[model samples]
Target: MTILAIGAAGIAAVLLAVWLKGVRAEYAVYLVMAAEILFMLSAAGRLEVILDAMERMRGYIRVDSAYLGTLLKMIGITYVAEFASGICRDAGYGALGNQIQILGKLSVLGVSMPVFLALFETLERFMK
Candidate 1:
């Protein structure tokens, strides 16, 4: 959380500086690039903690196994899609952003295919 806080503070400082100096919003894209770099550098370490938190939440709530994996996958898909989309947008490539979004959606569906199949089988069994 400290890294996140620091990054947020740095972004706020950059925006404030830009505003004070009459920098164009386009110039602020550099700050977004810097933040994306920081996220890329820090994400591996952060992912472990995030998974741990998810595990803890699952245990604390005793969530149904069928729901838990789906939720986790949804969260992962959202985060990855948002991160890719944001970076592409920040780089001023709307076409690339749209492509990234399409890829994200396709990748997510690919990853979720097995889970969906399992759920379908389970439903089939229940109906029989």
Candidate 2:
């Protein structure tokens, strides 16, 4: 979907949720969750295009496929963590959301460790 359509949908969802919050607060939360699912589904449809572009860039750049894969994984982790954390916070679980963000950061760090090691090794070689 185009950004304009997505923005419209998001605004509509928020407005409806706000109205619903006055009547049934729990339903408002459900509405938000449903909207999030819809938005995520819409975004998933574009992932292939993004992956194809990344692949093209990799072809031109001579970078390791493993590193590209790691970068993609890190991006995925960050998005999923942020998505989950936002939902948690919306549901009134701020602490859980914070923990999710922390875990996401740590997971990204862990996933990129190999790249860090390679960089350090390169630096060490230059130092010799």
TM-scores of all candidate predictions against the true structure:
0.62, 0.95
TM-score of 1: 0.62
Runs of candidate 1 with Cα error greater than 4 angstroms are 2-28, 40-44, 53-78
lDDT of 2 by residue, 20-66 (tens): 99999999999998988888889878889889988999989898999
Cα RMSD to the true fold for all candidates:
4.7, 1.0
Model 2 lDDT at residue 1: 82
Which candidate wins on lDDT?
Answer: 2
Distance (Å) between predicted and true CA of 98, model 1? 1.8
At residue 76, what lDDT does model 2 achieve? 92
Whole-model lDDT, model 2? 0.93
lDDT of 1 by residue, 1-128 (tens): 48778678667856764684465675677666676766665665577777788789887897666666776786678677878887887667888888888887887788778788878998999999
**Per-model C-alpha lDDT, please?**
0.74, 0.93
